[model samples]
Target: MDTMRDRFAPVVSQVLDEDPRVAVVLAEIGAADFQETARRHPDRVVNVGIREQLLVGAGAGLALTGMRPVLHTFASFLVERPFEQVKLDLGHQGLGAVLVSAAASFDWPAGGFTHMAPGDVALLDTLDGWTVHVPGHPDEAETLLRHAIAAGDDRVYVRLSLQANRAGHPVDGKRPLTVREGRSGVVVAVGPMLDAVLAATEGLDVSVLYTTTVRPFDTAALRRATASAGTDVVLVEPYLAGTSTAVVNDALADLPHRVLGLGVGRGELRRYGTLEEHVAAHGLDAGSLRERISAFLARRDAVPAAS
Candidate 1:
């Protein structure tokens, strides 16, 4: 299923075909790299040159004209070149458009840092009214894409990773479910890191909450999940420690919550390797998570119960 391009391609094509009023713009730098569906639906797909800023600005213009635009490009180019357009035209103007970012995170390893986007999450996460959804699987991708197409939200950003196989299930926009629940401690897991968190918490009392939607995170559910746990809830995200992560940590200020941020680390990831290797290096793998969880539990136990 790794190279199954035909699988999700048709789903995206079908959506573009169904919506006659909206425009689906796709901009790719190289040949043989464009989306199959966007190619199939040629009328809707907009092929701007290698310039990503113009691509996003054009999408914003389309959105201003009452046409819902879906901006498609690699996560690296989408956020890098079009920072002003995305932040001003779409975000500031409150255009109801969606940015479909591909190769999110280490999705493209052989392509090097220019291709890999292990930092896109932290970028869009900072934008106001920008909803970032990273579908862990193809089914989740299809469902989330459909929702974004129909949603009237101000702006939407969907990040697609190489580990899309683990996206699990398609959550309803109305009622998002709790993927995993624990008692003693709550681990707010996102992206493919859930695999690590889940494996580590085996036979443990910690609860794992996998968030598919970042902006509209189920705060109500989070509050309910951490209600009984009290001081054991830990807010974790794949982004390095920053405003977005800090805001999340601060959100649970009322309840004693510890934030364990997992990301590509503070400095540039100078080492070139596979995603697994990167995860191992960054201590986001199952083994590292287990050790961290064990240490956290030990520290908690060290503190005596109320007298």
Candidate 2:
């Protein structure tokens, strides 16, 4: 697996070895690499078979009883299936845990729609106080996982995807990192979308910024970048379309601006296929993104010059 999931197994194992407070509950996922880790620490790495509801509830109980519970499973099973458990069992209780999900968005298309969650972050947005981490690289994934484990009493969600950037970024758990500079506008690449976003915006005169943390939206950093880039921005997320647009809008309310939310097409409600197919169909492929973003910037330029 040329993805974050491959990198995460080791971190989980290390954490299990070192931290007594760190417990991992699984739902029939992570078996390949994590099985041995679970075997070594059976008390901590408990697998709940395919029962997702119990999977989440068990984590909540573990957290409630003073263990730093870390739950693992596919994005669809973790967030979409046992949503209420996540909503009430964890959110309402004001409890803290590390909810790590693999196979993000349409990563497991052969498994079909039964295994996709492009809107997971959007759903998490409705709930209060979740630090969502969507790392663009394996290094960032491990870094964010460590950050969450150290962050006492704070809930953290880490979404893992098959896509990755060319290199790892130096990202903190709280801010967006500016990767490139240009004068025309700013294109913010969220999580796994970085590599694709970078490719899509090549040769275009636009500032490029990246971030793994989605909520508690880093408007301060975004506002700064956009203000410098002429207050024009385009948000390219790796998940559902327009997921972060509202917060971005509120963030840049100090000035008149334009933003384009480029991501998985919400209107394309077809059965899941291969990752490439889903990505292309959503207009998230490099070519499609290039055209869309080019046009977006052109439209902004086409606006009559201010007197």
Q: Where does candidate 2 clash, by residue pair?
A: none
Q: Cα deviation in Å at residue 141, candidate 1?
A: 1.1
Write one digit per residue (lDDT tens) for candidate 1, span 1-307.
5522223345556766787756766665422443565566666777786878888888988887788887777888988668888888888888778887776666566778787666676777667777777665666667777788788745887766666434376566434356666567677666556666778778887667776677777677767777765555544455453324465555676765555455566665766778778777767777887786667666764541110
What tens-digit string does per-residue lDDT give for candidate 2 at 74-179?
9989999999999999999999999999889888787877888888999988899999999999889989999988889788999988888778988888888888
What is candidate 2's TM-score against the reference? 0.94
lDDT of 1 at 124: 73
| Model 1 ranges off by over 4 Å | 2-8, 29-42, 165-167, 174-176, 241-244, 301-307
